[model samples]
Target: LATGDMGIANTTPAACLVAAFTGRPPEEVTGRGTGIDDATFERKVRVVREGLSLHRPDPSDPLGVLAAVGGLEHAALAGVILAGAAERVPVVLDGVNADAAALVAVALAPAARGYVVAGHRSVEPGAGAALSHLGLRPLLDLGMRLGEGTGALLAVPTVRAAAAVLRDMATFEEAGIER
Candidate 1:
């Protein structure tokens, strides 16, 4: 499964990319990343707006969007998700950062969504919104905010256990037992 690594200011690029793709206003896509103060938050919004204006991403070209506004981790994770889809493997997304990256990946390759799993809900302000845009319901809601693949890692075991139950557990009839 694909997971994403996030850092400070990463959300800025994500918001920019989302705005570029969805035709949303920058403020609609922006959020108080990492709980920045009012002044810094304003600066963050300005930066995202400037970046979007400078890039003017071409919706027909996903790579241009990545090169224009995407972070290294976002680009890398997008690649990982794309590769996993090519190999028919499922990619479990972690949080907003991964959610953003997956949005780009899916925009590039619509088939990729079939290989993705939303792992959990993050406390990041834009996370829930992004997940909703993607039409994904997270498997958990522990109010996690960390984004180093932590949320996805936490959900992996539960996914595996469920798969095992479906594949390995025997029915009562097979076990010669009463229901």
Candidate 2:
């Protein structure tokens, strides 16, 4: 399974989710979405702080937190992650939105953390926080912040190539080569 998100201004709620889960400060998790200017970036950070302050979401109760601060897309992506975990499938998570949702999924099912693979690291600070909390290192980091699964898509080939190398590569003895 692979996860991606496409929505405007979704990073605001993502930062909120990261703060709620990781206990990070709003400004620490927040970032400029779509290249906003100074004032807009400042306001975005403020909005994230206000939302977290108002909601006071409990990370232990992921459902309650989602209800309080999650966007519809966040909830939807969380569902995908949960479903993938249920089936013991590895999920490739993309960007900040997917990272936030992955946090929600792990909170709901701690074992689910093992099933998530970070496709790539986003420039978004929240993405780093979420990946760190999940103990996941992204497979790629091309300074990507574009959602819509572009990063994940780019990572799929890498995953496949790695798998192929593990499965098909021959050892020195198998290749009849001297040690």
Candidate 3:
């Protein structure tokens, strides 16, 4: 399973969600999406802060927080992540939107964190914040911000290689190697 998104200004809600979950200030989590101008960036940060202030979503209640601040794409992505976790499938996360949804999914099921894989380091600050909160180290850091699962797709090969190694590599004991 992999999560990605194609939404306009989706990072605004993601920034709000990250702030609500991590208790970080909005400015710290907000980023300029699609290379917005300086003024637009400032407004984006303000919007995130206002949304957080208005909602005051509780981190412990993931559903409530998501409902209050999450966008439709975020909700859908979170559901995908939850389903993947329940099925014991690895869910590769793309950028900020996917990362925010993963936070919601993990909050609902703490064990779900194990199923999540950070595909890349998004240029969005919220993506980094959410990854840190989930204790996930991204497999790639290409400074990528394009969603649509581009980053996750790029990381799939690496993930598959790692799985192959784990499945086929012989242990030192099996190889009879001394120390």
Best by lDDT: 3
Q: For all the candidates, what are their Cα RMSDs to the real structure?
A: 2.4, 1.8, 1.0
Model 1 earns a TM-score of: 0.86
Model 3: per-residue lDDT, tens digit, 1-179?
Answer: 87789978899999999999998899899999889999999999998888888888999999999999999999999999989999998999999999999999999999899999999889999999999999999999998789789999999989889989999999999999999
All candidates in order of TM-score, best leading: 3, 2, 1
Candidate 1 lDDT score relative to the true structure? 0.82
- Regions more than 4 Å wrong, model 1: 169-179
| lDDT (10s digit) by residue, model 2, range 38-125 | 9999999999999988889999899999889889999999999989889988789999999999999999999888888999999999
- In each prediction, how many residue pairs overlap at the backbone (N, C-alpha, C within less than 3 A)? 0, 0, 0
Candidates' TM-scores?
0.86, 0.92, 0.96
User: Across residues 1-179, which tens digit of lDDT does each residue of candidate 1 receive?
Assistant: 84968577788887877777667777777887688899988888899889888878886798899899988978988889899899998888887788888888989999998888889887765566667767888988898777778889988888789789999999999889996
User: lDDT per prediction?
Assistant: 0.82, 0.91, 0.92
Query: Distance from true position, residue 173, model 1, in Å?
Result: 7.9
State residue 64's C-alpha deviation in candidate 3, in Å: 0.6
- Of the two candidates 1 and 3, the one with more favorable TM-score, higher being better, is 3
